[model samples]
Target: MGQPIFYGSVHVLFYRNDEVLLLKRKNTGFMDGMWSVVAGRIDGAEEVVSAAIREAREEAGVDIDPSGIDVVGVMHRKNTSSEWIDFYLKVKSWKGDIVNKEPHKCEELRWFPLGDLPETVIPYVKSALARNHDRIWFESFGW
Candidate 1:
């Protein structure tokens, strides 16, 4: 086989009432203790849209209404591993209370205003949030 087919991931940016949802990673993994949006790898035969919805439900314990989330453009990121991130904008109201179910993967989950976000946010995610509604990428990291 040639170069391995890169796997894509779906990321959801759920913003409401001037606050955005972020989770602090706790377990041992890449970017642990960092704050990030609900993201998950897209499984084979699974569409990115469904992945986004599933991730939000599983990670944040939020049931997203299908009619609400909108699929945004894809983001191509080339680091140690190259990937095409399928971006989705979920602005609709969701049911169920927010809970940090996966403490191993996430320590705490909370919403913060855009202007006063925590410093532990994943750098790439921070850039993405800053460029919400705009396709222009403002930053890049080799690693």
Candidate 2:
């Protein structure tokens, strides 16, 4: 009889023309071999937008200004053992070149055409991208 806790995370989508950046997960115990966007959990007391900016810089070697990004969608996903609230943000512009800053956790960094994403993309991530501009603010998965 306690309040349910849903962990919060941020996902950053970097766009160039009609393509979007994606990083292949590697060596990470969870979701290894899958492609995903730059993402990480929000630290305590951190604002969601701040977390998205931080994650983009940490994972993609890019600096995103607060005004250059927008929260496009929110996903409530339930996996086998945990629930997650993931905020998907789109980066209109950023500073610095994109790179795989976390080599141990990410295998490759590449851009794919929005209309031709790879089949290996993470399920929830693909869903978010497919609906990024549909004005759908909320989505849920796995019940």
Best by TM-score: 2
TM-scores, one per candidate:
0.84, 0.95
lDDT of each: 0.75, 0.91
Off by over 4 Å in 2: 1-3, 134-136
Clash pairs for candidate 2:
none
The number of clashing residue pairs in each candidate reads 0, 0
For model 2, residues 12-68, the per-residue Cα lDDT tens digits are 988899999999998889899999999999999999999999999899898988999
Which digits, one per residue and each the tens of the lDDT, describe model 1 over residues 45-128?
887667777888888888887776777545656656564554646546678887877777888888999999998898778777
Q: Give Cα distance to truth, residue 69, candidate 1, Å.
A: 0.4
